[model samples]
Target chain A: MFSPLIEDLIRALRCLPGVGPKSAQRMAMYLLEKDRDAAGLLASSLQQAVEKVGRCSRCRTLTEQDVCSLCHNPRRDHTLLCVVETPADVLAIEQAGNYHGLYFVLHGHLSPIDGVGPADLGLDLLGERLGEQVEQGISELIIATNPTVEGEATAQFIAERARAKGVAVSRIAHGVPIGGELEYIDGGTLAHAFNSRTVL
Target chain B: MFSPLIEDLIRALRCLPGVGPKSAQRMAMYLLEKDRDAAGLLASSLQQAVEKVGRCSRCRTLTEQDVCSLCHNPRRDHTLLCVVETPADVLAIEQAGNYHGLYFVLHGHLSPIDGVGPADLGLDLLGERLGEQVEQGISELIIATNPTVEGEATAQFIAERARAKGVAVSRIAHGVPIGGELEYIDGGTLAHAFNSRTVL
Candidate 1:
């Protein structure tokens, strides 16, 4: 329906996470028809990011530098490291603005059915970092992984490893969201909230 | 919260239609983390299309060549020309598969407020094409512009021009879609559907 290059552009656009064929076509047409300069900039930016962005050596979050700004910042509490499944999670925590500690991105949780394991998640590197707990003066490891089955399993695995290194491990609390109505809360979350209720 | 290049990539991804900051970040992260090769291909394809693709000389649709394949095709009915608002509309009609005629893309509708005149919509070129109606053997100009006020005004404007060239002009029907239920359909569409009822 379109020229070869235009068709190729649409197909290539489908690589984005949520873009399907129709959306990809719309995006390709919009770029070609309305915003060529933006398209050019996007192309160069994508290329540059693809070439430069890699996982931070310490935290495993995506970064262009050897050590990410968050990890390198001396003001942040390195003693309290938060473990998460992806860099996006790190961003979410940062946006929430309460955490003053550093982060360790696992990239993904352990999913054996999909063949994702500890090594695939750079757990060995995390283990090495945990081994240096005394030297690094890291007092606590916060497991901020999602509350899915795989996330719980990953948190448990990491907690065991942190305990082996004589470091305390804690999982972030999960209950009904702050503004959520109790009537609308799901059974699992309600049950957990009831069980983990603190004296308030 | 991301590195500089990653942040740039996210910002660039927002140039795509319907991509908000969150979606852009997800797209950027997905491309960088999951598929760098796809990202590279998307970048080159975007750059190539932006650099190489231009409006077809005859029809004004996007194409890499001098004239689009649809315009150059001998099998299509050149005597009937369907005028549309955008290349995406052209693709939509092409995908519907019943139209065997050629197309003329307006790129946009006539909007006096935004200073978009006939020249902006290539109406002068369309006029020239209509002038060659005698030699080209064109019998009808099918106006398939959208059913918006601007689209109707543009269609009326083009209809007058085609009439001056002694070419018959017809607007595509405005009615409820084929599979749509009357109860769920909008009042405007239902009213139009009744107004444009056929003899069936």
Candidate 2:
């Protein structure tokens, strides 16, 4: 459809989520025609990010430095750890601005069908951290993984392991979103909301 | 917010069409977390394209060589040229596979408020090509610009100019799309379809 270079660019662009061939072509043509400077900047920035960014040593979130800013910040509660499945989830929690605790990224859930297990997500590392944190008077380990079958299993597994080390474990509440209408909510979410009701 | 490198990549990625800040962050995180190799490939490919791809001298569409393959291919009908406002339009026409004639890309339509004029669209070059093509037995110039007010004005301006050069000019019809139901179609398009009904 186009020069090999242009075609290569279009195909390479599909690595991003939700971008299909048609969208890839549009992006390629737009960069080549109207936004070459930005394209160049994106290219260099992507390369820089790939070359420099790696998991934070303490929490496993993507960061340029060994420890992420959140983990390094003294204002955040090191005694409270929020565990999530991926770095994107960590970003979502941070953006909400309600959580002032540090994070420990699992990178993925324990999906048996997909061959992902506790060892694969560095649960041993998490167990070690939990054991070490108990000595430092750490109070809670919040499981913030997505509310899927695998996520539930992983949370329960982590809870059992952390409880053995004398650390308290809690799951993030599952319910309808704040602005959601109940009529439009799914049955599973409605059940969760009903099951988790608290005193007014 | 993330590290400076991550932040820069996210910001630069917003230059792509339809990608907002959240989408950009998701893309950046996905690349960093899962597909670093593909991310590297995308970065290098973008750089390669920005460095190599330039407008075809004859048609103004993007190509690595001096002339686009469409203009260079001898099998295409050289006598009939389809003029469009952008390279994306060229891709759309090519994907339709109905047009066997060559293309002349204007890069953009005339927009007075944006200070885009005939010269801005390389209309003088188009005039030269029209004049030269006429001597070489080129007969028809198809104006395939979009149906916006600016696009219509640009089409008319080019039509008058080409007609003055003794070349035949035709506008691609504005009407309801082939599979679209009349009830679902816009009034302007339905009216156009009514006026341009072909005798079956």
Candidate 3:
């Protein structure tokens, strides 16, 4: 007979982003039979991520430190910031290996129905970050939020706020779809979108 | 910039059964962004399992010791040995919660084209095991190999050899169709097969 501890371990493993019951069971058995170390690693990661990974103080990107690596790196252009919806999005862009600008992870797209607003995110800080243009010597703000209606609205709001501060602002060009994501969008289309971005 | 070490980590992570490129990427990002401890744990476990976990010396069942639990359990009917193709099959039978018999893991099915034979699969030891029945007080031998053609041949060969030693031996039942597995078969069918097993 299996122990309750093993059952609890399987249940916890099932909470991973896309792991289902069958996969969980396979993983559980694999851990129990052939790979207890892998199972233990998975468990430790779940606990560590839940406890440590949080929004970076500067850019809202998920980070183990106060500031994310992108935000702290001097080599990246602080003057040009490409904002994205989630940390997962940051990974997708990094995979493409082209984007050299700093990133601001919004964590969530604005969803009025979901009760998320400008203040719900770090929009105030973003606005302030943009308003420090003369001192920080900033130039462009690329609104790389998703093209869903909520994403569009958020982009527009940010663009207007940036323009009011007398800074140049642009949104990523639309080629994928109105409701699609940068993550699922192919790399070539994303490249073209980046190359042909227009003013908001 | 990402290092090859990161890539190596991702590549090693992708080796986990059923994990694809996207899942591997997500896992890598998860480790980097939030779960370094998990990564370390996984790394250690991979190294540990790779260094250990060989077949049981007695029964060829996957084990960290000379004898597997099923073979070592004093309560198990050592005289009534159940033969199976794989350790996974052993687990499946255990999950069914019916069979309380001990197991001898063959590690593979018979395939003439693959050059697998009785001697190659440690059948010599099995022969010795069966040959010792009168002295050890073993009464019955259960052939629980798969229902495939190769499985059937393997079971037949085992029974012929074991029965020559003068013990009551029976092949595990068969009612299911071709290429079907006992794990996915309905409990009713499995139960029926178990109860209605015929002598071969």
Clashes of each: 0, 0, 0
Range of the 10 consecutive residues with the lowest summed lDDT in candidate 1 chain B: B129-138
Q: Per-residue alpha-carbon lDDT of model 2 for B6-79, expressed as tens digits? A: 99999999999999988998898888888999999999999999999988999988888898899889899999
* Model 2 lDDT tens row, A32-130: 888999999999999999999988888888888998999899888889999999888887898899999889999899988999988988888788788
In order, the B-chain TM-scores come to: 0.95, 0.94, 0.81
Best by TM-score: 1
Per-residue lDDT tens digits for candidate 3, residues A1-200, read: 32334345456545445678667666655765556555545444434554566667878876656777778888887788888887778777888788788877786778889898888768998887887745475688888898777888889888898899888998766776678987899987787678777689
Ranking by DockQ: 1, 2, 3
Q: Name the lDDT value of residue B78 in candidate 1.
A: 88
Off by over 4 Å in 2: A133-137, A176-182, A192-200, B133-135, B193-200
Q: Is the docking of candidate 1 incorrect, acceptable, medium or high quality?
A: high
For model 1, the DockQ equals 0.85
> Could you tell me the lDDT of residue A123 within candidate 3?
90
Put the candidates in lDDT order, highest first. Answer: 1, 2, 3
DockQ of 2: 0.75
Worst 10 residues of 3 chain B by lDDT: B1-10
- For every model in order, the fraction of real contacts preserved is 0.95, 0.83, 0.01
- Each candidate: RMSD to true structure? 2.3, 2.5, 8.0
What digit string (tens of lDDT, one per residue) describes model 1 on residues A80-133? 999999999998999999999999999999999999999999999988887783
Score residue A178 of candidate 1 by CA lDDT. 99
